[model samples]
Target: MIGKLGQTSRRYRDDARSATSRRLVIGATGVLTALLTVIQIAAMPAGPTPVRHPLAQGSVWDSVYTAAQAARGEATFRKTCAACHGDSLKGIDDAPPLTGTEFHKSWDGNSLSAIFTKINNDMPSDNPGTLSKPQVAEVVAFILQYNAYPAGKADLAASADSLGGIKFLPKP
Candidate 1:
């Protein structure tokens, strides 16, 4: 009976040792995982701050498109944009108005280049992105003329960089 008791005690000790070892291993694994996660996050490289376009900081009051260009733009607008925007650019059903208080409010304090990019990529519902660079510039000029912005002697350039250099300002 004593020998049996000794054997049982030995078995109990062996089982307890295994359970303690297993718990130690699990705790170590959790600690190691947390350490590795922290190390990975710390090792990651930092990214640069985003830079705003020069035009975004400027104003539409600055010299821009010419009167002749606006006239040409008006002609193109009549042919291409009149259907959806209406003959007077007042907009139709589902299409937002392209002029007046609402239009100016939407574009106020924004970059002209952003507007140009939007029009270049998407316009004329049935035939989006079909307008040429110069044609796009002309249409922009027409919109500016309609808004009553002062016209300059030089024409507005169609390039993104040039357009971005011109900011959209609130009407005086």
Candidate 2:
């Protein structure tokens, strides 16, 4: 009877040790997983930071482009953009429209600088990045005019920093 009792006690001890080992392994795995997650998050790249320019304080309604500039932009558009964007500024196959409600839906509340950058970087589809900064500004001016935005005495500047300050709001 004594020997049988001792064997039973040993079995219980072994079972308890196995349970403790399992708990320790599971706790260690959980901690390791948390540490790995923290490390990965720390290593990830941050998103784009919002740029704040003093000139960007005004909206496009403030007459940021001149009529002369818009005319120049229109000429450039005819030569460079009409094939894809159409004579009416309506989009052709795979190209998006650049005026009216579609334009507002895409660009409302965004900065002129954003559109300027896009034009400078990605316009003319087939001949991307070919337009000079001044040309891009002119194109933007023309687009504003086509949308019936009021013209000012000053031409739209080619400076992205300055353009960045002007917000593109839906026509009032």
Candidate 3:
């Protein structure tokens, strides 16, 4: 009976030691996993930052285009867009007007980039995608001039990013 009791106690000690070792291994593995996750996150590259321009700080009410640029745009419009939109920018047939109530309803609260892209990709019904970026910018300037938007000293840039920053608000 004495020997049997000793054997049982020894077995219990062995079992306890085994359980402790198992706990230690599990704890170590959990800590290692957390450390690896942190390291992986730290090693990853950051995302690209957005570019901001001082000229595009506000809506179109801030005079984002030059009068000279608008004149150039008007010339281009006469040569390429007048036939469909009319010499005075009133809609003719299927072509939509670029001024007044209809124009404001269609374009207000939108970005200038929206109109620039539409004109760049789909103007001059006979020759879509033929106008250059600068020409498109000029055309947009002319439209803004006709809508009674004030002119700035700088010409409107031919950049989509820049235009995207300028909002087409209602006349102000």
Cα TM-score per model: 0.64, 0.65, 0.66
Residue 152 error for model 2, in Å?
Answer: 0.4
Q: Which segments of model 1 are wrong by more than 4 Å?
A: 1-57
The order by descending lDDT is 3, 2, 1
lDDT of 3 at 39: 100
lDDT of 2 by residue, 77-124 (tens): 999999999999998988889987887899988889899989998898
Pitting candidate 1 against candidate 2, the one with the higher lDDT is: 2
Model 3 misplacement above 4 A? 1-57
Note the residue pairs that clash in candidate 2: 56-165
Tell how far residue 76 is off in model 1, in angstroms. Answer: 0.8
Clashing pairs in 1: none
- The local distance difference test score of each candidate is 0.83, 0.88, 0.89
Cα shift from native, residue 37, model 1 (Å): 74
RMSD of each: 14.0, 14.2, 11.4
Native RMSD of candidate 1 (Å): 14.0
- In the range 38-131, model 1's lDDT, one tens digit per residue, is 9999997665864433543356665588989999989989999898889888889977788988887888877788878878888887889899
Backbone clashes in model 3, listed as residue pairs: none
